[model samples]
Target: MGETVLYVCTTCRRDGDDPEGPRAGARLFDALRVRAEGAVDLRVEPVECLSVCKRPCTVAVAAADRWTYVYGDMDPAVSAEIILAGLAAYAATPDGIVPWRERPTEFKTGVIARIPPFPAPRPFPAGTPEAAE
Candidate 1:
């Protein structure tokens, strides 16, 4: 099984203020670290930027041979629960194909992008079936 990775934007700041306290992304990572300890097989790593500057708190869920989900406009305090829920759902799937209905509201509404998995070579040509007819 592939490892689920939560890519957090550590550089994101709320209200554009420099704060001594932890940023939203860092806070989310810390919270998840404690909450998911020994429960989920996932990793939370801080990233410099996801390029979604308008959205202060952003996160990306990615795994090998799976779709990558990017969500934005989040609040660490409230969003972690939904994020974790989504992660749980994603982890349960073989190819990480979590249905839209299974995803939490945060994921559904805040999604900035859903990147498809990397392409692989097709087993047979597209016209093979048609040509046989």
Candidate 2:
């Protein structure tokens, strides 16, 4: 399997936070980076925005030929370890579909979206009637 990337939204910030201070997402990214050091299967990246402004501290996990997941409402001070644990589970799976029971509590509850793999499989085979039209 290929490396899985965890994209952290660096610009995300909670309401009422000091605008001049570091953003929650950036802090989360730093935390994850520290914990993910030397990890061979996962790469942590920072993105400017995830477009979920209402839910600060957002992240996305993705890999080729696997499902992509976005999660929101993360607590920057404490979510890094949980996120890493979830990433480990995701990396161990063949198709990035971690069993619900095995996923971290935060991942199970904070998921904002789950997208199918890029270049998703066709719903019907090329020679089938469904594909004829």
Candidate 3:
């Protein structure tokens, strides 16, 4: 798996209600990428539809097959921090549980769906995952 793992909803707000669907998700992802450097395996892909339009612009982090976290309603301001925390959790464990309380509040319960990995657009970081830029 890449250094940072990210699951992006391609058509989150397909309906009329989801204005901030993929577009907002894209911005958040771009910012996260800039902050993540390369050590964190951060892969952003648009999924067909996560089926949770209410929570448009969903984001997830999957690693070790044991834990996959899903979070939505992502405001760009917090996205970078969220991604970093998720990466830390992913890196902290052989599984992907960074303690119960320590886990991201949105993903504390876990993600809604767990899809397959992408082909590989952006490669994983070679060394340590840097802090957000």
Candidate 4:
């Protein structure tokens, strides 16, 4: 399986947070980075924004040929472990689809979207009539 990337939105700040202070997303990224140290198959990245402005501390997990997941409403102080657990479950799967019961509670409830893989699979075999049409 390809490496899984965890993208953290660094510009997200919770409501009422000081404008000049460190963003909650940045803190969450830092926490995840620290926790993920020595991990080989997972990479943590910080992005400027994920376009989920209303939900501070947003994050996404993706891998080649696998579904991508966006999760929001994370709390920097407590969400790292939960995110890491979910990431582990995701990496264990061939198509990035973790079983609903195995997913962390936050992941089950905080999911913003689940995007299909790029170059989506064809509905019919290449030599079939459907493919010819």
Candidate 5:
């Protein structure tokens, strides 16, 4: 129902190496951007950090009315396509809930966090009768 956004930690370096070369997260973002060209429902955004420094090259996927997923320990060169595949599955869902079995192997193993969506309060329960003053 809503757009899926993939947020990558651009400053994350593989193995804590000096950031002289392209960071893995940035490379992943670039690859995903190229793959998602002309896509309206899926978007790629670069971020500075996601607090998963221990697992360099992290990414978080989120969407309105859906659970958010944070993945870590990613190898951008090899994981980019897998991440996109996972995002595709997420975008195809009405609530962005991609089944564990359906997720790409990289995502399946790299998932660092799964956060529940913020609940929307209901005005009233179904089948309730109208209140009279």
Candidate 6:
């Protein structure tokens, strides 16, 4: 019932443009993380390049068993709201599928593609357990 959000830079900033080289994604991720710290379960990460150049800063979310989507050209100011809303929707879904009508069109419009859930994680890996003896 948790989610991980990733803000991917579709295009690296032009040389000498921002000096920081496409920081909107970073800024957005940080804002969202702080806002969702405890109210909800969410994780934010930055990715190298998402390849949607024309759009610039973009973000995406990957849920346990739902459609993976990408949102492009997002304004840093509203990134947190977008992320929090998306997380809420994902958590509410019984099977992690947010209906088309329910999705935020503002963000969903940039969806590059849909992907299945990522590899499952082991509860307790070898050498790491509840009671090691």
Compared with the true structure, all predictions reach lDDT values of 0.82, 0.93, 0.62, 0.93, 0.84, 0.64
- Higher-lDDT candidate of 4 and 6: 4
| Model 3 spans > 4 angstroms off | 1-4, 13-22, 109-133
The per-residue C-alpha lDDT of model 6 at residue 78 equals 71
Q: Which ten residues in a row have the lowest lDDT in candidate 4?
A: 15-24
- lDDT value, residue 83 of candidate 4: 96
Per-residue lDDT over 1-133 for candidate 5, one digit per residue giving the tens place of the 0 to 100 score = 6788899998888875656778877887888788878988788899988999888789999999888999998887778788888888988887778888898888888889999987997566556674221
Where does model 2 exceed 4 Å of error? 120-133
Error in Å for residue 35 of model 4: 0.8
TM-score of each: 0.80, 0.87, 0.61, 0.87, 0.83, 0.67
Q: For residues 35-101, could you state the per-residue lDDT of candidate 4 as single tens digits?
A: 9999988999999999999877899999999999999999999999999989989999999999999
Backbone clashes per model, in order? 0, 0, 11, 0, 0, 0
Cα lDDT of model 2 overall? 0.93
- Residue 128's C-alpha lDDT in candidate 6? 66
> lDDT for model 4, on a 0 to 1 scale?
0.93
Worst lDDT window (10 residues) for model 2?
120-129
lDDT of 1 by residue, 1-133 (tens): 7689988898777784548787877777777677777765688888988999888689999988888889998887788777888998988887777888888888888999989887896567667985555
Model 3 lDDT tens row, 58-122: 77777645556677776655657776776776776765556767767655543465445343556
- Looking at model 1, the pairs that clash are none
Residue 5 accuracy (lDDT) in model 3: 64
Off by over 4 Å in 6: 2-17, 20-22, 118-133
